[model samples]
Target: MAQEVFWRRKTLREMNREEWESLCDGCALCCLHKVEDEDTQEVFYTTVVCHLLDMNSCQCTEYERRCQLVPSCIRLEPEDVETFDWLPITCSYRLIHEGKDLPEWHPLLTGERSSVQQANASVLSVYEVRDNEISEDQLIDFILDED
Candidate 1:
């Protein structure tokens, strides 16, 4: 019999550093800017992404210092998993936290880091511009249509 995969067997809090890091699919949807509805507390994703993200690779150029450079950049941690609803439905961390399996295109599942990009599930397909290219007030105009 085959052993259970680490993600299925381990809780977010139980995984070690390397195992935790490997769970990322690298879609970069988290790098995009988001807006919240003041009344309903609903979050909306925007087409404007962080300028520090290298679009082609869908990786942050300054991974270590991202939160310092961009005040809004979120640093995902196991402790924050409960509040991960704002993350995309396909997000690996959110999926695991919610007791869901990684999507077929997830790097961990496919053993190919480019699967997310190849499947067009990456920010490269949705981003219209970098955050620095637009004014803060213009974020509403960049909200992605709820599909």
Candidate 2:
């Protein structure tokens, strides 16, 4: 019998490290800075990104040392998915955790790595501001609508 596709067959918690890593579509929206309301608890996305994120490739420049280099950087794990309200709706991990299918343009589905970019899901062309340059007072200036 043919082997089942890993994503459809295994829950995020059930997937091994390699399987889990392959599920990432590499949009890099997670690397962007966000602001949360103190009382309202609303999360806002911003164009400013982590210094470690490569604007051209939209990948972390230092994947393995991210935690050490940026103490506040969140390394998302299976258990953390459900509670991460800031995850983009197009994120493969968030979609899987919410029992939704990957979008047709997902690399795993289309077998084309550029599909996500072609579909306009990747944030490659978004503003290239860095987190280190932005102050708390200026966060609202970079706030972007989720769409």
lDDT, model 1:
0.92
Alpha-carbon TM-score of each model against the true structure: 0.97, 0.89
Could you give candidate 1's per-residue lDDT for residues 70-96 as a string of tens digits?
Answer: 999999999988899999888899999
Off by over 4 Å in 2: 1-3
Residue 141 displacement (Å), model 2: 1.2
List the global CA lDDT of all models. Answer: 0.92, 0.83
Per-residue C-alpha lDDT of model 2 across residues 1-147, encoded as one tens digit per residue: 999888888999999999898899988878777888899998888888888887777788899999999887889898887785678778899898888889999889888878888888877756557888977688789987666
Q: Lowest lDDT 10-mer window, candidate 1? A: 102-111
Using lDDT, give the best candidate's number: 1
The best candidate by TM-score is: 1
For candidate 2, report its TM-score: 0.89
